[model samples]
Target chain A: MHMADALVSPAVAGAMYAASTAAAAYSVKRVKHEDDIKKIPLMGVMGAFVFTAQMINFTIPGTGSSGHLCGGVMATALLGPYAGFLTMIGVLLIQCLLFADGGLLALGCNVWNMAFYGCFVGYYLIWRPMTRRRLSGGRILAGSLIASMLTLQLGAFSVAVETLLSGVTKLPFSAFVAVMQPIHLAIGFVEGAITAAVLLFVYQARPELLDDKGKSGRQNRFSYKRTIAVLGVFAVITGAGLSLAASSYPDGLEWSIQQVAKAEEIEAEGGGVYAAAEGIQSATSLLPDYAFPESENRMGTSCSGIVGAVFVLALCVGVCYAIRFWGKKRIK
Target chain B: MSKIEGAVRELHRVDSIAGADRWIHRIYPSVKLILTVFYIAFVVSYGKYQLPRLILMGVYPIVIFILGDLSFFDALRRLRFILPFVCAAGIFNPLFDRKILFYAGEIGITGGMVSMAALLIKGVYSVLASYLLIATTPVEKICFSLRKMHVPAVFVTQLLLTYRYISVLLEEAQRMAQAYALRSPGQKGVHFKVWGSFAGQLLLRSADRASRVYDSMLMRGYQGEFSCAAVSKCRQRDIGYLLVWLAAFVALRIG
Candidate 1:
């Protein structure tokens, strides 16, 4: 579910970056307020542990293929959400830079998809509630399984939505969602099972680690309402900013909506909000239909553009070789 | 097991190569980071059918590879796993979009074909830009640049520590895997039945090690933040490099 830079437009990427940055900032603040200096090294080591764990693949029963741990739910279960989210960010960033597992520009989307859902939504909704009053083997297993599957589904759905909104692909929204959701369901199941196994082991070995108060022995006082309010404001800002940006580039979100609804004419006759937005869109649209100003000789322009591109590539290669040659002479 | 070993070696290879002294490597880390981001943005911002313009963006990576004394084939080899997935994502483009875009001789090229080609180019270019940045800059320097950019100290501290400990943990995991394989031969991977004990044991060991690590840091008067001795100042050439790349990116976008 790692999004490549090619799959997202700048507008969508920028909006996601803003959202992820806000989330990260909030998480850092919360972690700092806790003031557990020991968590610093623990978060780092655990992040590395997750990284190593992923490389150790396990064989699936009755299937020829193998699966590995995602560790988002496990991290959250052990470290709580704030620290877990930051640890996942560390893991994802290293993967992006070292292995190219995901793209740098698309890091925001990947973080939101992989880290945000599992750390925040999985913890608050599934893991916390399930393990709230008591700790049991069955609760640990069930919580890990449910949280993992649900978060993976959300992450997969977000990927589909992001790709569609980017409008770089020709995939229809329904078809993309249809294809993405089911494959992830299987992947999610495997992830859930493995997460359950790992968490179950920890539960038996060191039950204190799985306690609701977390490792610091303090109550987890993170407020759901406050978080939601902050994130809601971010969502509103991102939505408005994207809408304004999408107006100028009609081929992105606008194109996706048109394709999905097949309702290009609805906005043509609508009043109120639609009419006002349409007015703003038309006013801001530089290339109304994503077409350049009329060119008399289109083929001629294309031919020249191709030639210019080839010339520039050749020039780049030539300069590179020249630099290498000069460096060799200096060394000699 | 081999996968784990290969990954460890791959990380070392990239890290070692990044220490090489070269013109591109000598350029400021933050500047290269910004340029890489801009390069990717420019490549992605192009229209779907704009294959020619997209192809032109390839120059940045190609020049950087040569100047950095890096191998293009090595980069491609590193990207082998991801490139296929990237291609697979766009493979449906040709099927969904069949509008005939232009004619080549008597053959009618569809919009799908052009966009598919454009997507492939975009993927390769973006991946290369990121790989090149990390290939040239060390992880610590990159983290330093991130801190300089006002990314929170806690996150930067986490990133540095995680990177530092990754090699240690990989070694430990490899040793454990070797032990597991020796005990259970003919097993494809650690069985699902033993996953609890196998991974759980590792997790327990890791937590213990982390506690000891924290103790050692505290002994060294560890604070919540890290300070670096070799502070990199932006040179005149760094500014020139930034301006030149910015101009080139702008020109390519306009052209």
Candidate 2:
């Protein structure tokens, strides 16, 4: 699932944006350093290939829900990881901006979770090893399934951790993990199967396209092992750090209320600008209850307050509309 | 709408809206991009219980809808698909966070309910703000802005080319689906068994097309860097756009 902007805190979102931007910049450098003009068109076309393929949603069995292709594993398989990473970024950016699939802040999270893992980690760790020298269907199938599933699991878990770090949702880390992991596992399997099938077909139809740049999978395997190890440690540190903060902070609503209440108590104990603000508030207290004059019960007061709020909202909307009309007339 | 048809319509709708020349639309793409990011971050920075304050951020999207000449209801409708994910995650809030924070009549409004409201509001406002960005700025202009912002040229070129070819490849996919539908009457979308082959064939076809495109590029004195037709210049209005949105966003965040 694409992580929505609301799911992340500014800190988590900013951190992710930085991470993804660095990774993207590295990918761009690698792609640029190569400067292979032939591969440039391949990158663009393959991105579009993934985008179009993603549109053809397939009905998942038994659940009746439809799922589409992610295309990351497949893109990585076809165009080595660096180029693959760039392509996935392009696809996701278009999806975020044009389709509104995800928000701008969360785009960083999406790119890292979806593209970075699928291209770099999945490519080196799983797909490369499985498809070495042999173009067999079984190898392709097994590779895609494992790689796609791994990337998706990592992506989904990252989303869970992001929300945990954001601490915006009341979803406990365990519960979020429990819910996110299994669903993505299923999606990952389906996407992996599709990725395998397509890659297998492409390999059979034209083997050269699949085999060219993915030549040094063995050389990179060593580095990836260390990369994966480092990532594991990083995850643990962040997860522990964030969960600690999450547990200590009461839910956002209560925390804010406590802060406000604490501030008000302090204001009452002292006196200054607070007294002036209180004087003004008291002066404008028409009903002395921020509600209707005849309202007796708490429910009545709340209802009247709601009515007044709606009235003010309507007035605001009317004024905006009037301004728009006036602005259009003046422009004409 | 069928998923494919809806995808096509969405692609066209944003492209058409971005072509509009209103004040919001005319604002520099980089300025709009920065504002969109700032607005979303501001909306999301609030605590989950800050629903009322979060609601105030609705003015940004509402004002955008009016100025950008976007259809409000249509924008909301486009967001409907994302609701299920938000709801699935949010539905558990009330179940998990049962500490009663306050009460309205006999009903106790728990922390879960308040946080859930905050989550939903955050999701809606952020999504709407992003929708406005795309609705007002064309993809080409966005790529130009990204380039101007010092994004790597190769990456930007890929983005531009990929966007340009999405519609073309989608049409190709549409044709393929139609042909398959005509032959396999009473079938809904391409059958699962055919998906692999169908997607494989599409990839193969596109790969061939890409090579042909490369050949054409070579014939036309191909350069490594792809150049854009549009010149990106930040006029005075663009600076004003950036400053005003940044100020508004900062105010929202602090207030």
Candidate 3:
């Protein structure tokens, strides 16, 4: 569910960056508490652990394909949400730098989609509540499976939503969701099972790690409620903004076209001001039709296709050579 | 099996390049970092059908790659894994958007086709820009610059430490995988049944190592924030670099 930079517009990327950074900032602040200071190395090491875990791809039984763990739910279950989220940022940063698995700009979106949901939604809503009554192995497994699936689903949906909002691709919202959700759902099940096994093993090894007082403390009045409230408000604001943009998008495109076509309509009415404007437009326009010259002959399409291909190829070659030339001169 | 080994080497490959003595490696990391973010933001900010303008912006990555003394083929190789994602995001465009954007003679070019081309261009360019940045800049410099830019010290420290220890953990994981593979011959990958215990063992080992690392840090007078002596001072060229690229990006965006 990693989104490429091309999949999002600057607006969508910026919005996600703001959202993810806010979450990261919140986590950083929470992590700065004196009590939380000692977990820094643990967070770092766990981040490494996550990175390494992804490499050990296990084959799914009865299927030839192999899959790896996502580690977000497991991280949260092991380290608590605040540290878990930060650890995720670390793992993601390394992955981006080393593998280019997700590019730099989309890092924020990747983190938001993959980390935030897994750490917060998985931990608070599903894992915590499900495993609260008793720290049984079965409970942990079930919690991990459900929470992992939920977070992956949420992440996949966000990818679709972000792409739609950006309008970078012509993927309609429903179609994009239809394609992304089910595939991610399958990946989520495998990830969930892997997560459960890992968590269960850790729970068996160190039960205190899973049931720490800080994590399970019912006395903390502000933790879950405040976080949920903040996230809810953020979601509402973003949702409202996206909906407004989505509704206006088609009309916006048509309106721009109307301004061009309407220029002729105004000329038909024969106003002096309109004629002068039309005269200027005709004189200044490179393409007289203000769009691609519609030719009835197939030759224009074929010719342009060849010409455009050559032009693009030549441009790329020219740029590369120029850079190389400049580099050599600078070195000399 | 071999995938694990390949991954470890790939992770190290970039770090090895980052240590090379190039002008890009010498520049203030913050400048390169900020410029990369701006370049991406500007590139992606364009309308979906703005293919020509997006193509112009591709110059940024090419220039950076050459100036950084990096190989274009190496950069392209790094981009191999990410192309599928870009393709997946865009493959349905021609199908979903059949509206004629314009006609080139007898043929009607759909908005989807134009946008798909634009999307692929944007994806490749953005990935290249990011890959170039990492290839040229060391992780420590990035973390240090990030700290200088007022990113939380804890977060930066985590980034630094995590990067440092990734190799160690990978080595450990590789050992376990080798052991598993030796015992279970002819298996293409690890059996799903052992994934629990296998990953469990890795976690146990990592937890033990993490505690040991914390103890070692305490013994070395490690405080919460890492204080390094090699603070990078921003030079005049750094500002010039930023302004020139910023101006070019703004111009392209306007186009």
TM per model?
Answer: 0.89, 0.89, 0.87
TM-score quality measure for candidate 2: 0.89
Poorly placed runs, candidate 2 (over 4 Å): A59-67, A216-222, A240-281, A285-315
Candidate 2, residues A133-243, lDDT tens digits: the string is 676888888999999999999999998888777876666889889988998999999998778778878878887887846553334432567668857866775766556
Q: State the TM-score of the second chain for every model.
A: 0.96, 0.93, 0.94
Provide interface RMSD per model, one decimal: 2.0, 3.2, 3.4
Clashing residue pairs, backbone N/CA/C < 3 A, model 1: none
Superposed model 3: Cα runs more than 4 Å off: A216-228, A245-332, B101-108, B229-231
Top of the candidates by DockQ = 1
Residue B242 shift from truth in candidate 2, angstroms: 2.5
Candidates 1 and 3, the one with greater TM-score: 1
Docking class of 3: medium
Question: How well does candidate 1 match the true structure in TM-score terms?
Answer: 0.89
| Candidate 3 lDDT by residue in tens digits, B82-201 | 889888878888988887766665788887887788888888888888887788788899898898889998999888889989899998888988988899888977788778889989
lDDT of each: 0.83, 0.78, 0.80
* Model 3 error, position B67 (Å): 3.3
Write the number of the candidate with greater TM-score, choosing between 2 and 3: 2
